[model samples]
Target: MPSPADKLRALLAQDKLHVMPCCFDALSARLIEQAGFGLTFMSGFAASASRIGQPDLGLMSYGEVLDQTRNIADAVRIPLLADGDTGYGNAMNVRRTVAGFAKAGAAAVMIEDQVAPKRCGHTPGKAVVAREEAFDRIRAANDAKAAGADILILARTDARHEHGLGEAIGRAAKFSELGADILFVEAPRTVQEMETICRELPGPKMANIVEGGETPDLPHKELEDLGFAIAAYPLTLMASAMKAMVHTLERLKSGQDRTADLMDFGELRERIGFNDYYEVSSRYETSRRD
Candidate 1:
C-alpha cells in the first residue's frame, strides 16, 4: 500500500487545489476521512484549544502534540499535515521534531518562523526570529526529511505582519531553495497579497484561511485560480464544533432535549466502529469454543 506521504504527493501532482480541513482529535480525523476529504491538517491552535482548554499561545508541549498527531494519523488513512510550532526550540530541536512527527505518522510537518512559544498567526502581538535563525530551522527540517523521514517539510513565514509582504516572500523563497516541499506565507491580509505569494513562491504554496483571520476568506475556486496548491481551513471545524457544543449545553440547561436533533445512539456507535470490535469478539469466542 502507498504511504500517506505518497498519496499526498500524488494528489499534489494533479492539477487541482487540495483542500485540507483542520482536525482537532481522532474522532474529527475519522469524520474528515469519512466525509471524503483527501487530506487533513492538525492545527496547533485547534489542538491547544481542544486538548488544554487554552489559547494558541504555544502552551502545549512537544509530547502532547506528537501524541495527538499519532492518534489522529492512526484514526484515518488520509494524509495528515501537522503544525510544529517553532519546532519547540532551535535548529537541533527542529530536527528532533521532524523525526518525531514523521514517526508519529504525519505525511507533512509544518515548521514556522516564530520565536519559541509562538503565538497564533491570527493573534496580535506576534514576533518572529532573526532571519538567520529562521533559515537554520528550515534547513534542519529539510535535512531531517532527507534523512529518511519520508515526510514533506512545510516551511511557513509569519513575517507579513512584523516585517512586510516583501520580507515574507523573500523568506519563503529562501525556504523553498533550502528544500522545503511547500511554502506557507501566513496571514496575508488581502487577495492581492495572496496572489503575489502564490505567484512568487517557488514551490507548492499553502493558503491558510482561518475564520476571522487577517487573510480574506476567498472561495476555494478563487484560491486555485491564484495558483495556491493547498487551501487550509484550519479553524473552521474547530470554531463550528465549539459553537454547536455551547448551544447544545445551553439547550440542555433549559430543560430541552436535543437528542433527537443529534445522531441516533446506534448510528453514532457504528460511526465509531463498534461493530468492528464485536466482530473481533465473536471470532475470539468461536476460537475458544472450538
Candidate 2:
C-alpha cells in the first residue's frame, strides 16, 4: 500500500486542482474520505475551536495538536496535511514539530512564517517573523525531512498581510528553493495577487479559500487555471456543520420539530461504523463458540 506521503505526491503530479475540505477531528476526516474526496487538511482553527472551544490564537499546545493529528490521520486513508503552527518555537523546535507530526502519520506538515501566537490567516493582528527567521524555519523543517522524518514540508508565508505580496512571494520562493514540497502564500487579497503567487512560485502550490476571507473564493477550475495545485476550504465544513447544529437547537428550544434537520439514526450508526463493527464481531463470536 502507498504511504500517505506517496499518495499526496501522486496527487500533486496530476495537472489539475484538487479540492481539499479541511477537517477538525477523526469523524470529520472519515466523512471527507467517505464522500470520496482525494485529500483533507486538519484545520488548526477548527481543531482549536472543537478541541478547546477557543480561538486559533495559538492556544492549543503542541502535544494537543499532535494527538488530534494522530486521530485524524488514523481515521482516514486519504492524505492528511497537518497545520504546524509557528512550529511551536524556533528553528530547532520546527525540526521537532515536523518530526512529531510525521510520526503521528501526517502526509505533510505545514510550517508558517507567522510569529509565535499566530492568528488565523483571515484574521487581523497577525505578523510574520523576520525574513531570516522565516527562512530558517523552513530550512530546519527540510532538514528534518532530509534526516528521515518521512513527511513532506508545506512552507507557508503570512507576510502578505503585513509586508507586501512581493515580500510574500520572495519568502515563498526561498522556501521552494529550500526544498519545500508545497508552497502556500496565505490570504492573497485579489485574483491577480493569487495569479502572481502561482506564477512566481514553483512546485505544488496551494490556495487557501477561507469563506469570507481576504482571498477571492474562486471556483476550482479558476484556481487551477491560476496554477494552484490544491484549493483548500478551511472553514466550509465547520461553518456548515455549526450552522445546522445551531438551527436544530433553536427548533428544539422552541418545541418545534427537528426531525427534518437531523440525520436518521440508522444512517448515523452506519456512518460511525457501528454496523461494520457488529458484522466483524459476529465472525469472532461464532468461531470462539466452535
lDDT of 1 by residue, 1-290 (tens): 98878888898888889888999999988888889999999989899998999999989999999999999999999999999989998799999999999999999999999987799999888988999999999999999988888899999999999899999999999999899998999999999999899888776899999878889999889999999999999988998888989888888999898886678899889879887778777768675564
lDDT of 2 by residue, 1-290 (tens): 98889999999999999999999999999999999999999999999999999999999999999999999998889999999999999989999999999999999999999989999999989999999999999999999999999899999999998889999999999999998999999999999999899888889999999988889999888998999999999899999999999999999999999999888999999999988878777778674464
Q: Candidate 2, which segments miss by more than 4 Å at Cα? A: 286-290
Q: What local distance difference test score does each model get?
A: 0.91, 0.94
Superposition-based RMSD of candidate 1 using all C-alpha atoms, in angstroms: 1.7
Candidate 1 regions off by >4 Å?
A: 286-290
Superposed Cα RMSD, model 2: 1.6
The clash count of every prediction, one per candidate, is 0, 0
What local lDDT does model 2 show for residue 46?
A: 98
C-alpha TM-score for every candidate: 0.96, 0.98
